[model samples]
Target: MPAFKQTQRVHDDAFDPSDSASAHLYISFGAHRIRMGVLDAQRNKFVALEDYEVERPSTVENAISFLQTQSVSNPLLQERKWQQVRIGVKNQQFTLIPEALFDLNAREEYLRLNAVVEPEHEMVHHHEHPRLELINVFTLPAALHEWSVPQFKNSPVEFVHQTSALMEGMLHMAERSARPHLFIYVDKNYVTLVVLQGLKLEFCNSFFFTSSEDFIYYVLFVLQEKKMNPDQDAVTVWGELLLDSELHEILRTYIRHVQFGKKPTGVGFSYRFDALFNHRNFDLYSLHFCD
Candidate 1:
């Protein structure tokens, strides 16, 4: 299958060539898709958004190829003199550790203890959450890491785990509410579940599923294991799901209080995006919160 790219040039006119210095570049890569957003730094609002569906080999080479094409074809990327660049990776084998006991040198062992398979080319990265007193440790393919370095060599680029960005985004959302919330970020065949008990993370894990039954089973299983009542607790879902979709239908059947998650209220988006659903591209948009 050939890769299909969809771009929404909402604020193309907003990109002022003279003010290119006040631009920030954000890119996110997952198993099934690649998404990039360009923001006007001064205005703090997104000016452009691009999404690419992975149909061919979902390899680093294919992803970089798509990115290179975008860099050339997308006027924003080619013309803008971005001041900052941020990349988010949605790879598996990410786990959280208590910040107090985090050891940089022992990341491999920690992952091993958690049953993460060691890859030949791997790099360990951690995101520290001071408020939660937790550190998220994850592995990224060396190929992807090496490929990204030279692409943004002109600027200091920050690499963040997609889950970490999701956590940060969810924490921001949790701040407004006092109740416990279950956040499910759905991808192609996997879902990242994060349980929040009043702004404090209680449980975070990723589960892979092949069928709708498997998906609902894992969600319910996590709820049961966490001692959360489906009837009483709230579940907010985001990403790659439609209201008429089977996944949504199954979830509604079991969970009494399930709703689509909203876009991060902390950031601003162009008015052109008003027609788009707030729940779509939750993780990709959440990359804005990564620091």
Candidate 2:
């Protein structure tokens, strides 16, 4: 491949440019209904290519088959033949996807619910949507829902939380490279802890990444492997947490845009969350979080 060609792809060229995403099928195992759409950028809506239900599948294979073999006539099959598929589950979410069954990683994506909390979460938690720069988040209304999350009756919150984060991660990932990526995080308890770019999130990632250091190391590795800079023209992040002097004094160095859990930046947007990570003692720039 040529170098300039790669650069051209990263920075889209158009009159009105924004990230584009599509779903051959948007099945929420949690919610049986699914939305198949071409992912329109101007509509600011799913434009649902197809609307229906899959009743949720119990295993990864069954779910993929449901999506792949799902009647070719279904309006949801936008690509006709998807080179990949992404599955997002939430709360009591369940079922795995391509990554779970494959030895090769880049071919699929498995986005669990709420995996989008950190960057998208904080960014939206900071700047309102339909307005934020570069990165963004959007609800696929009339698209997908957790009618019945695929999960064991008494699974664990950790698993569920990581799954949610993974889902968010998948949305962000798909929105980024138009492909899947691996996910690992801690929403409450279950921590896949190892996030791999390109391959979509999935059930049972065989790798384990503990500690922020372990996580950052791999990210840096990806940067080097993909040849990106930590600073300019690559991914940037800001984070938040509940205000606690002791915790602040201990981990503040790690947090990006933290404040107390009282006032949040966007009270008018569709999102909901207390900005409990700010402090009266914060410097001027950080004070913006309180508004």
Best by TM-score: 1
* C-alpha lDDT of residue 290 in model 2: 14
> Against the true structure, what is every candidate's RMSD?
2.2, 18.7
Clashing residue pairs for model 1: none
Instruction: Please write out the lDDT profile of model 1 over residues 133-169, one tens digit for every residue.
Output: 8888888767677766776666667778888889888
Q: After superposition, how far is residue 12 of candidate 1 from its true place, in Å?
A: 4.5
Q: What is the lDDT of residue 198 in candidate 2?
A: 41
lDDT of 2 by residue, 1-291 (tens): 111100001111221111222211223322233332222324322222233334322433333344444535333342333211233332322223332243223111222332332333221111121111111122221222221122111211111122333333333333345322322232211223223344433232312344545545554455455444444322322222223433333333442332222122321111111121222111111111211
Instruction: Indicate the TM-score of model 2.
Output: 0.25
Off by over 4 Å in 1: 7-9, 16-20, 79-81, 115-120, 175-179
- Cα-based TM-score, every candidate: 0.91, 0.25
Total clashing pairs for each candidate: 0, 38
Candidate 1 at 115: error in angstroms?
5.1
